[model samples]
Target: LFSQVPLVEIDGIELTQTRAILSYLAAKYNLHGKDLKETFRIDMYADGTLDLMLMVALAVFKTPEEKEKSLALMVKKDKTQNFPIFEKILKEHGEDFLVGNKFSWADIQLLEAILMVEELDASVLSDFPLLKEFKTRINNIPTIKKFLHPGSHRKPPPDSHHVEYRF
Candidate 1:
């Protein structure tokens, strides 16, 4: 979908951040919320979450001791805080999609977030039924489902073990 409408051709706009690209695509494709303020709020939250997840990934790549400390903190934050927030959002939205009951970029961002976190710590998902359900639900979407299948381009089972924490 994005490739068909490359960012370069969209008024010659350039976006340095993934979140910016997402926002631009959302607005361009009418996937954003009804109002600008709501769209801004959703984008801000999505970007913040992505930033935190990036930090967690960085920590996972650190030295052994640092990785242990980082992962411990991540486990705490993910379980006690982040996961619950996602659960609430999904429940509040009452739809598989994230914002305004549509298949918006926020949903894609969140699906990637869950997949990345699971890769880092497979056990991290065990306790979050909502998150697990959400992942399963998102993976069932037609476009996403095709990519999640065994022979698909975006399959997760293959590369997941490469970064398996030995701790």
Candidate 2:
């Protein structure tokens, strides 16, 4: 019933909202969580990661001068704020994944968010050693590794042409 750019259709059903689509896929793939509490934790982490992702998304639409400023601000906030929380979680949880010591949507979201920031600043995770390790660990997963291989479906960072197209 919904119509939008991110619409996803499967099994004769269509999901238009980003969250709805992600939730559906997460649930179907068994990445949501094992219980309510775990689901809440996964949602919390995924939402936080989305905040970072949004910043990167907005940066791409800015002029060169503004883009640099936006990216710098994004990196500053990520280093001083967002990255620390995730680093702490990895430290205290003593787990490879962010929630329940199992691979979940949260891990996938965080890895994607981290990579987006790294596109602007290669050393974005330098201060967060745990996050670096986490990225490496997640990147090595066979499925993810295959998806990340060159010529995969991954979209490159947005360029000036994207900004023009959006306007």
Candidate 3:
């Protein structure tokens, strides 16, 4: 059933768990990295991206005032905690990609998270030079460039329909 998701059957198998689906695709596309060590690093970055996404997700359910507060917190955590971690990794690795010096799942995850935050606050990346460069680099990639264009399938930022102020 895929939990009401549109029919998605890969290799005749139905994957319900989020990580399982991502893992399968990453493995199939050779985005899991070269070896276990690389995979570990990629997974760490992927998890970090998920954490960033969760912060934004939490803000979607709050009232306007609460949403503002939550988003401020999200930006603060991102600027002070999340972005610095990735900045350090990119600076130290000195590579085009986050791990193994090659494009992988980690790079994709980070780029997606970066864009999502940028949508909320355009200046979210102002102080993160490497990440800013990283975004430009990733955005220039042929496939990603096309995918990011208007009229593409990329989901837009959360809107009124997606927000709910629960008691």
Candidate 4:
């Protein structure tokens, strides 16, 4: 299985940016959102998830000690600020998924975000009931469950390849 997964190519047009690719597929599959307002809301949450991912990505390639310290700070900001925003969104929406209650791209992104943070700290999500439930709910979806089964595709580690990386 290819690492750096989720690379989508359609009609010879290749997309590499994760959010853009996911959003494109979501739009194609009618999972983006039901309306314009909801689309913007989905974008906000999806971007939040992207920010979480970036925090981890930026830390990669650093010295181990530096990575550890930087990740710790990122976790602090996440737990204190970023996470509460989504938690409140879920609390306010009172729905199974984020945004307009439908299973949108943002829900998928949130599950990715949860998995990314859990990489930093296994118990990081313990305090966030909504996020924890959201992760479990997304995982239980039949198609998603199969996709997530062990030995499936995985995102490539940033430093695993020599690509002249930089922040």
lDDT per residue as tens, model 4, 76-155: 87788878888888899789998777898888878877777777779887778998888899999998898878887865
> Candidate 2, residues 32-130: lDDT per residue as tens digits?
878999999999999988887877777777778998888888888888999999999999979999999899999999999898888778988988999
| Alpha-carbon lDDT of model 3 | 0.84
TM-score of each model, paired residue for residue: 0.69, 0.91, 0.87, 0.84
Clashes of each: 0, 0, 0, 0
Per-residue lDDT over 1-167 for candidate 3, one digit per residue giving the tens place of the 0 to 100 score? 54543234788877666677788889998998788999998998899888878778667666889988878877788889999999999999788889988898888889999888887789999898999999999889999999989999997766677544222
* The candidate that achieves the highest lDDT relative to the unseen native structure: 2
- Evaluated at residue 74, the lDDT of candidate 3 is 79
Best by TM-score: 2
Output the better candidate (3/4) by lDDT: 3
lDDT of 2: 0.88
lDDT of 1 at 146: 79
Task: Tell me how far the alpha carbon of residue 26 in candidate 1 is from the true structure, in angstroms, after superposition.
Answer: 3.0
Candidate rank order under TM-score: 2, 3, 4, 1
| Cα lDDT, all candidates | 0.69, 0.88, 0.84, 0.79
Model 4: how far is 125 from its true place, Å? 1.7
Encode model 1's per-residue lDDT on 34-137: one tens digit a residue. 77776776686577578757666566357778876876776677777887888887777677666766666667677777876777688877877777887888
- Model 3, stretches more than 4 Å misplaced? 1-13, 163-167
Error of 2 at 131 (Å): 1.1
Q: Residue 58 deviation, candidate 3, in Å?
A: 3.5
